[model samples]
Target: MGPGNRPLDLEWLEDFLALAESGNFSRAAQARNIAQPAFSRHIRALEEWVGVDLFDRSAHPAALTAAGRRFQPLLEETLAQLESARIKARAAHDQAAASLLFAATHVLSLTFFPQWLGGLESQLRLGPIQTISDSFHACEDLALQRRVQFVLCHGHPEVPGRLDEAEFPMLRLSDDVLLPVSAPLAGGGGAMHSLDAAEAAVPVLAYSEPSGLGRIMRARMRQVFGEGSSVPTLPQGVDIVFTAHHAALLKAMALEGRGVAWLPRSLIAAELKSGALVAAASAEWNVPVEIRLYRQRADMAPAAEALWTLVQERPPGSGGR
Candidate 1:
């Protein structure tokens, strides 16, 4: 069958628009952050799919042919209509689903969510759960987009979450501490590194920007070490040797004796009990945080509302371990 008979790709249409706007293949490709060859292929594929010559190849800056000019308005309108339909469909699907969607940071998704969900199951029979485990930044994005019913992450009232308090209601679920820790020395003598030590630099395994714990750590460090403290920055007494998005990965690195890491105490409880990890700094340096759940201002699925209500009814210091 000819290209005209096949399904059209919206991406190609977008490419066509980009190429038309830029007036040069190389410029459009650069703007789109795609290789020039790939951009040319997209344009060619678009033309082939439409079975129309959209651009004048001989023109110095790639002027559009008659067919191209005529197709532009129709393509624009079609794309807009398609986008509107997609948004409406997604909203309807979200409204119709009985289950709750949660976006949780990786560490909490592993350590806290299962236990919390188990506890809630006895109180309320949740229909089905859809949880996305990701970095705090990604979870925030999901919550902001209203793609998920809830966002669960470590929140420090001192350092606000990405979602504005006015737009998203928050419930403090539990209290957790960010503990500065490192692997015990050989033969389990002592911690491999200490923040208190007057060493040249304390090698550290740090978290990437996307991590909630990383944000908390950076905020706390700034408060403790003054404004000079920032992630991977050369603070007066510390040096960040490595950076990662996952707290579990940083904990693993700390266990390997690579460097000190500030890990959630809940996550490394087993390791701490086994004498594999030790506090790298005093209690004074530890950052206190809350395990919080955030929801949009708008109403959610009934199951999600019930879950939220159940959580709110819990007395202070009841749910957290």
Candidate 2:
């Protein structure tokens, strides 16, 4: 016994099963790519470890002893389970190695992230990406808490928020504009109910207070229309009738002719093209916004750093739709 036999190696167990299946020491050794003497030694080691003879050598094609027959199934199952564990462990390790996590606002996650990521994949060696799609506030929290490597959201130059671009480095990724749009009038032909309609009738579909686009729009509205005449208050004096956090939900309501909504051009481009939605306000009311990515100043995982570098190299609007 090697070193007075602390324990038998897993190879000895495998050798024992191979011999049981092949029914010949020489054949088992050949199948295992080892010499007969080594194979016999492995079998002897396993038998010694188990404290019993495992095979009847007197048989022409060696047959299993009663103990070996019982041990055969047990060893086969143990090896299978260990192999499975090995695969899962390697998979987990690879995921940890390549993972780059991101947090994004709901609208961008749906409309922009996929296309933007696809373009990067065409040029870079991106591994795995995990994106958490949430409300703007939630996404900001994830970034500030260091739970995610990057935060992707819509940004306006003048608007201020929790994540100061000064503290967290930012990369402008693309350009988009906010359009105040409404559903086409019931009879159609590309006409829409006006945002400047009767005070009582001008139902306003609005983003909730915590929305990122809403934050931008609020600031821009005050600058464009003056404090008293912003989006919440029409020139004729009507407040928002419906409010929600998601742009998609607001779009749905607007499509049903419920009210006017300030939506992203990227989000409602199809509707605008098809005459399903029309501008609710004039050019002065439109807000120019940038698609921005922000990352902590601290160094992140190598995969995340590589992704950040790739994004920084691309010109704004490089692969945008």
Candidate 3:
């Protein structure tokens, strides 16, 4: 806490505690995924509010001042209890509170999300649900604002700290495919004969840019095509590929044979199994991604927990830790 300029914001108290525990602003920012400068400001605001020097500036790794030490456990327990109460309140109003918002990469939205909900309903025995899609951080914002009870997204390098990392015991659905697929049954048939023929004939459908799947495909394509090569085939028949967009649109495009489309095997499983679509190459072209559910350690509602538990119990072939 600083020497008194602002009233204490309990939220800052939490940030102060996280900073104290981590002891490095950069790491703390990464853990928080906010800019370090912004996090520092929050810490400063906290100190200003509390009217005390919370940490020893001269010390390395940010040791807390006597005042901070004295205050830690009290704040932690108090916040925990307050959060517990919030969860109960949410459960009591779950049906009306039943408004849920989560995000997913296109693949999850297309494939597993639907499957998971069906399973979630069967498990929780719920009827009618609401959901939305956006990038991972959007879910983080919504949850922080209490706009959503939960979030689901692909696990990535910075994921653990970006969202609250609780054990969301998952049931893995069948590993899905995201190989190039085509809408025109005839267009797809020729590519099935040989891998070389497939690569040679069509521009591999790829996510447009700056996306996880797109990044993976770009690196892999370079490795396969050779170093310093530009996107091996141009106009590679992109049916407007975007892994971040809605899955249903991608699926519709592939089903229409707009071009060779990379999409989830799980979403197109029935199509592929029925021979309506063919993998552009073998399954080797696609990467397996996760669809984990998350709730903050302090903010899960009972109905939310109930939904999570249902998600946890389903066949977890695809949704593992």
Please provide TM-scores, in order, for all candidate models, with all chains considered together: 0.70, 0.67, 0.50
Ranking by lDDT: 1, 2, 3
Off by over 4 Å in 1: 1-95, 223-236
1 versus 2: better lDDT goes to: 1
The lDDT per prediction is: 0.84, 0.83, 0.59
- TM-score, candidate number 1: 0.70
Backbone clash count for every predicted candidate, in the order shown: 0, 0, 16
lDDT for each residue of candidate 2 in 134-245, tens digit (9 for 90 to 100): 9999999888888788999999878867887547899999999988888887777543656555445566777888799988876777633236444444546445789898
Mark the 10 consecutive residues where model 1 has the least summed lDDT: 228-237
lDDT of 3 by residue, 116-186 (tens): 66655554655445576665555556666666666665543322424544343333344443466665446
Cα displacement (angstroms), candidate 3, residue 134, comes to 3.5
- Give candidate 2 regions above 4 Å deviation: 1-98, 189-191, 197-201, 223-233
User: Candidate 2 vs candidate 3: which has greater lDDT?
Assistant: 2
Could you say which candidate leads in lDDT? 1
